[model samples]
Target: MNHLKALLIKFVMIAVVLIVVLTLIFDVPFMDSIWTSLVLTVLAYILGDFLLFRLAANRSSQNVRNMIATGGDIIIAFLTIWYMQVALVDANGSIALGSFIAAVIIGAGEWFFHKYLDGNVVSKNTRTTADLEADYKK
Candidate 1:
């Protein structure tokens, strides 16, 4: 339930950023913006939030973990938006600029979101599944 809430929050943030930059500014179709948002949100949460953020948090300070996760989120956002626009929408030359803008905005939002996750959702000292399994076997 908590994870679901976090996912929804991340989706809304990505969706709004993409819609504003891609649809309103770059004239992308509304549905394309939505599709891009959905894909980016899922990928980012799994890779950036669930995997990278948690892994980095184990070894680094809160600030360092946040920066690493945010950087990963930015890269993921940029690639996903760029691919979606170029391959699916066949967007104009402005696609790169629009994706860049949206990605930056999403990264900014993710920094704060990571903070929220740290305080309210994700624990900094979580154990990996492998560790748990190894302990159980011992």
Candidate 2:
């Protein structure tokens, strides 16, 4: 239930940002922007948010962890949107600009979302070996 809620929030946020950047700002097609947004959202949620959080293992400060997650999101957003723009719009100059804009926007949202996940989801879902051992002893 929590995972579904989180995914829904992420999807809406990503879709809005992509729509505004691609359709309103860069003049890309609406449907193409939506498709690219959905793809980026799912990929980033899995690869950037979930995977990176697991890899970090609560080893760093929340800010640092968020940075790492956001960095991954930025890279993913840039690459995915750039490719989409190039293929769909045949855009050369706008590709880099649009991708950069989308990345920055997504990165900001991802930072906050990472914090939320750390507080609500990841902390609930993960436990260290020591924690498990202590629980067994109890």
Candidate 3:
């Protein structure tokens, strides 16, 4: 349930951001941009959010873990945008600018999304009542 909620939120966030950025800023076709956003959102949720967050769980600090996950998210978003531009957009133009812009915008939203996941989903197991009490003392 938690995973599904996170995935849905992620999909909606990515779709909105990418649709606006790709269509308005990059001049990508609206339908193509929507398709690209959907594909990228799913891939990013799997690779960036799910897998990277799992990997970051081993880290001691929640802040550090979130940072690592955000980094991975940016990379995944960038690659996905670039690939979509190449394959779907079919433009001879360089994708660097569009990819970078989209990645940065998506990455900003991802940081907050990751924070929500950390609080609501990922940190639940690690944050026992005893742990909360201990932190309160400090």
Best by lDDT: 1
- Candidate 1: where are CA atoms >4 Å away? 128-138
Candidate 1 vs 2: which has more lDDT: 1
Task: Report the C-alpha lDDT of model 2 over 21-111, residue by residue, as the tens digit.
Answer: 8899888889999888888878888998778755653444567667877888899999998987788787968569889988899899988
lDDT of 3 by residue, 1-138 (tens): 888888889888888887788888778888877887888889988888777765664434667767888899899998888888888877656566778888998999998998898777775565434356556889
Runs of candidate 3 exceeding 4 Å displacement: 57-60, 126-138
- lDDT of model 2 at position 105: 93
Best by the TM-score measure: 1
Which residue pairs in model 3 clash with each other? none
lDDT of 1 by residue, 1-138 (tens): 878999999999999999899999999999999999999999999999989887774433679888999999999999999999997787788899999999999999999999888887876467745446656889
How far does residue 52 in candidate 1 sit from its true spot (Å)? 0.7
Q: Each model's TM-score?
A: 0.88, 0.85, 0.83
Ranking the candidates on TM-score from highest down gives 1, 2, 3
Give the RMSD in angstroms, all C-alphas superposed, for model 3.
5.0
* Candidate 2 Cα outliers beyond 4 Å, as residue runs: 57-60, 128-138
